[model samples]
Target: MSQQSVIQIALIEDDEIVRLAISQRLQLAGYDVIECADGESALSLIPTGFPGIVISDVRLPDISGLALLPQLLANNPEMPVILMTGHGDINMAVNALRDGAFDFLEKPFDPDKLIETVGCAIEKRQLQLGANKREEYLQQAQGLDQILIGSSPGMVELRQQLVKIANIDTNVIIYGDTGCGKELVADCLHKVSTRSQGNFVALNCAAIPEALFESELFGHEAGAFTGAIKKRIGKLEYADKGTLFLDEIESMPLNMQIKMLRILQEKLIVRVGGNKSIAIDVRVIAAAKESLKDNQGFRQDLFYRLNVAQLYLPPLRERGEDILLLFEHYVNLANIHAKPLSGLDEKTLLAYGWPGNVRELINVATRFGLDASLTVADILVTKPLASIDSSASELSLAMQTQNFERKVIAEALRTHKGSIIEVMDILDLPRRTLNQKMQKYDLHRADYI
Candidate 1:
């Protein structure tokens, strides 16, 4: 790119020779100059594309240069304004400085000093923009919207299921590995549900200590436990008529499971030390990393009750092309926090097999923003991509090989950009096996196309 296409600076000066000289100096220093002879012309350009710094002569033909300083600063608080004054107007320049002018340059100033002051102004402007971008990222991160950012078939199906399930009050059990966005799915269910107007209360079953789990879930009356100086309301009572998301439900102890089952059956809760059973109308959304068959500690009866409606969240690697969509979303988010938003090269993206899922994607993107000088290799060196051939041989050599074959076929579909029939033809697999593999790998052709 040309030097003029890069840095943009606005210069407001009345004298023809002086304005041309300064603009030429800036242009030679690798800045795109916007020359405005008077305050009126500069005011007109402000709304279109505001410059990073304003260099205005104190005495202008159209407007008092001093008056324009405050107006420019008011419109763009982050913009730096450097005043240009004649030798006798030193006191005027001093007053302008107190009024928030970045600096004042007396006429016949040194060329090096002018360049140095402008450099400082531009750096300050960039710093301010960086801060604003960080704030925007935090807001987007906290947003609880269904911005489905994956191109994987599993994600598409998961979203479709959510659309249907959100209308009913059936208990949902979401199963997924850690960092697979189980909580995000739970939030989506609550947000899209008919009871969205009601509260969404989430409790991590694994995070709470076993001793306080009962009191935390069921609350207590005044003078019940050691610290129960006043009557305390439980999450169930607090979430009455709303959705209560019980994350990591498999971590719930057997004793608590029995009590939870009783509460689910009776629709009422008995406090830790209180006899009065309070009635509650709440929907439960439970999540666990392990499947029901794999859960050794959880009660089977409770599992059946909660799994009335089930959602199995797939891992990041399982969602093939969806990775790009998520990468784009995160890069845009990072642009707000970083200077000069950078994009991902194909090699960088394809060389890393993300083990930590979506959470890991956010972490890497955040780091890239803070240090723009980093290249793809430096940023993603920790998570090296696993080889496809190694995975293929690791499959059990039996009927289970069929499962492995299907997975390889599904990956072929991903590599070929999701042509199901085309992939089947290329792999020479039967139509039946291809269909089975697609379902097994959660690879939907529609998403690829």
Candidate 2:
């Protein structure tokens, strides 16, 4: 509602007597009317700020009101449109709605009903405008959910570096194994930094072919190469005033690396076959799996340039407790997709080392969940229970406990047909106690029968 208590409404009608009657009724209902005799004139007034609502007859001279609806919305989608059609013009009203006309009032409409429809349309328009503004704010904020995962000493130190370096505009080199979430760390820095609102572009140096690497990094003028039919924009230009992520930098061609070094020095790029140099303001985030010190082929000068700052990601095996945290995260994700939840059985968790890191844990958890019948016991049994070496009596105790745990759970599972509640009752234990024991012995009731 505005300071003007009466809402301003535009009416398009060729019939004079009906228009007067409708205008009189609307005026009495606290509305200010701007009347038009044809659709073309009404459409022209749409951009001139005639009124908040448009009430138009379907059939009009010059242009049909139904046909003008789309053009009206293209100019200002917030304006509500109510179409007026005669009894036999139901099809036109339906077409108006499909084309995004807010609402329709069939000719000979009740005055009160028409007023209600306009009010509803106004409310919906306000809601949409608010929602759009909120979304814009969220996009600008770049939200904080992109932080990398880990709790190892290496990871903790890396996070400390991120917090310290986010304010500085410097090149960064990230080192990590494949699937070790190096890119995730890059994203976190970009989002948390002062350049959060700018574009964050990524290119895999290894994935791009050698033949097209030059053209891809730098734009080209029309007729630059044999197949270069048109002028094109490049990633370097697109990432201006933003951040560019160069992944697998170790695999970048030596020739391209040299060109990149020059670009880093000059802060400008010359397109292929184009002499004009375009100045760019961008930050670079380069990543590689190999150590900069060990890789002799990597240009030491280039490494030094990118290494203005560096962050190393620890593999999953090194983050002892963080492995279980990641495991629970995956389980929750699986549940959202209607998959079963699973956790590591004690024996299997303690036995098999996670060589594939956090990525391996997610993969194994996904496999376990998709096969919903798999339980703790099944996971334990599949893993080898080797190396019971100890003092003779201690080794005997270990074997005896493992066998006893297995036998009790196996008999209980058989008798109960794998009903979790029934098994708990037979064992006279709480659900967590049963689950703990099952995990301890690597026992899965689902796999037993």
Pairs of residues at least 3 apart in sequence or in different chains that clash in candidate 2: 346-439, 376-443, 377-443, 377-444, 378-444, 380-442
| lDDT digits (tens) for residues 165-255 of candidate 1 | 9988889999887778988898888988987888899999999999999889999898997889998888988888889999988889889
TM-score list, all predictions? 0.53, 0.54
Clashing pairs in 1: 133-336, 151-322
Residue 268 of model 2: what lDDT?
96
Q: In model 1, how large is the Cα lDDT of residue 285?
A: 96
lDDT of each: 0.73, 0.71
Displacement of residue 439 (Cα, Å) in model 2 is: 7.4
- Model 2: runs farther than 4 Å from truth? 1-146, 336-351, 375-449
Model 1 misplacement above 4 A:
1-146, 337-344, 382-449
Identify the leading candidate in terms of lDDT: 1
The clash numbers for all candidates, in the given order, read 2, 6
Candidate 1 positional error at 196, Å: 1.0
lDDT by residue (200-252, candidate 2, tens digit) is 99999999999999999898989999989999988898889889999999989
